[model samples]
Target: MSKICGGIFTSHVPGIGKAIAQNLQNDPYWKPFFDGFDPIHRWLAAEKPDVAVVFYNDHGLNFFLDKMPTFAIGAANEYRHEDEGWGIAFARPFQGHADLSWHIIEHVVASEFDPVMCQAMTVDHAVAVPFELCWPGKDAFPTKLIPIAINTVQHPLPSPKRCHDLGKAVGRAIESWGGNEKVVIFGTGGLSHQLEGERAGHINVDYDKFCLRNLAPDPEALLQHDTLDIVELAGSQGVEILNWIAARGALTGSVRELASNYHVPISNTAAATVLLSHSERVLA
Candidate 1:
């Protein structure tokens, strides 16, 4: 049976992409955030997962406000990246695991969750930036891709509880698959930062810390806040934390934090990275 190795959660701010393009990682302003990945690099080298199921939000590269599904999963042979007017150089196309994608799609639907299935999709910084941070300077990504896009950009978005439930469903789907592939789950975007409106450029350090502290030990604590409450506390754009909440839901095993780093004011967002390892056996 397939094994879920672990999950990595990080912010997907577009400015991070531009920083990589210009080689600004070591620069003082970016050093602390870039340094956070050092332990993640070591962990990836050791665990070496065969597949990556990414939970991220699409930024107009593939979906728009007019027609956005609450959840979408990619089932393509290859996933490409395009400049979504961010001006960051496009990374090489990532190879997709179509077999696994289909398995997940079938399982999730059987489990009573409807998600749009895309055979051809273009990923934006949400997917690309995290990949670069995980395995910097790679000519090609090491793991086969399964991109799951969540609708954090539109109104009536999935509540934190709903996204968490979706992750639980996906986790069960992976464990039930017959393949022996080792998998890693990624939840990208947000700690806290708001853009636009009168409350633009808002950052909630206290609430961000509360989330980072509880995400591993007690994700249930996060679900108490409805989407509107999250907007009030984390700001409108800060609702991206829903992705992290979903990713944490997928770990059915006993989870332990391997490493974590939190820094503020990265592109007007509270930048954070967390590495969590799951036990080999699922907890009952």
Candidate 2:
């Protein structure tokens, strides 16, 4: 049977990508942010999972206000990076795990989570930035990808609890696959900092820490807040916590937080990163 080795929770700020592209890791402004992933890089170098189930939100790259799917899964053979209007050059295409992608899509829908299956999709910073952080270069990208796109840009996003339930379903799907591949899931985005309006640079340090503290052993605690509640407390874009909740839900048994880093004002956001692994007693 396949196994979920672990899950990664990260804040995928576009500026992080720019910092790396500009080779500013040693620069004081970006040093801490870049250093935070050193442990993650070492961990990935050790684990070498065969496939990565990446959960991210597109910042209007593929979907718009006209047609947006609450949940979408990419089943393409390869995924290409997009410009996102920043004039960033596209990265090398990421190989896809079609078999695992189909398995997840089939099981997710069977389990009552309606998901739009995309035969093709373009990944933006939300997806690309994390990959760049974990696997520094294209040669270092160890696993095929299964991109899971969630809708958080528009109103009526999935509730925190709902996202968790969906992740649980995805976990079941990965575990049920007969292949012997190892898989890792990633929940990208959040920590706080609203962009727009008068509160453009608001950062809720207390709430962000509260989430980091309770995320592992008691994720259900976060389910109490609706999307609006998160927006009011963590900031407008703080609703991205749903992605983290979903990734946390994907792991069976309790999680062991391997590493965590939090820094302020990473281009108008509270940047954060966490690495989690399943405890010894996981569902088989």
Candidate 3:
């Protein structure tokens, strides 16, 4: 059976993608932010999971206010990145693992987590940016991708507990699949910063650091946080940390933090990244 070997957690801010695309990694202003991913690249090269179950949220790209899903999983054979009007371009399309996607859909749904199965979806920066950060290359993505988008944009977002529960279901689904694919789950978005209203530049670096310290081994403790608390402490968009919680839940058992980083003002957002490995080796 296919098994989830590990997971990656990071922010999906668009500015980071633009800096890398423009080759500004060496610039002092951007160096510290870009430098954080170096260890991730090495880790990706070493682990090289066959498929990445990327957990991200759409930002007014595909699902608008008209319709939004609380939880959605992409079952497409291929996914093309949509232009979020940023014009920061040139990441190739992502290849999707359809068989594994279907297997996961079946098991996850049966496991009582009802996620809308998307066969065709145009991914936005939420999906593309983080992919570039971890597996930077132009030819093609080194690993196939299965995007699981959570509804962080809408007001009535899922609770942190719900996201974590769904993630655990996904981990179970991946493990139950009778395939040899090595799977890695990713929870992308948020270290803290609100991008709207009078508090456009609000950031809570201390809370973000606190989250980073506990996310690996004590994710359940974070479930105590509600949307209101996150907004007040972190910022309105700061609730995006729910994505990180979901990714943490997918790791299955105890996780070892391989690498972690944090940077503020990555385009008005406090971006962060953490790499985790399952304490017990998961073999296919």
Winner by lDDT? 1
lDDT of 1 by residue, 156-222 (tens): 9999999999999999899999999999999999989898988899999999999999988899999
- TM-score for all models, in order of appearance: 0.97, 0.97, 0.95
Q: Global lDDT of each model?
A: 0.92, 0.88, 0.85
Q: Quote the positional error of residue 158 for candidate 3 in Å.
A: 0.6
lDDT of 1: 0.92
In TM-score terms, candidate 3 sits at 0.95
Task: Give each model's clash number.
Answer: 0, 0, 0
Residue 180, candidate 1: C-alpha displacement in angstroms:
0.8
Best by TM-score: 1
lDDT of 2 by residue, 127-213 (tens): 888888888864746788889988889989998888999999998899899999888889999989799899888899999999999
Candidate 3: the clashing residue pairs are none
RMSDs, each prediction?
1.2, 1.5, 2.1
Count residue pairs with overlapping backbones in model 3: 0
Task: Rank the models by lDDT, top first.
Answer: 1, 2, 3
Q: Model 1: which ten-residue window has the lowest total lDDT?
A: 83-92
lDDT score, residue 115, model 3? 89
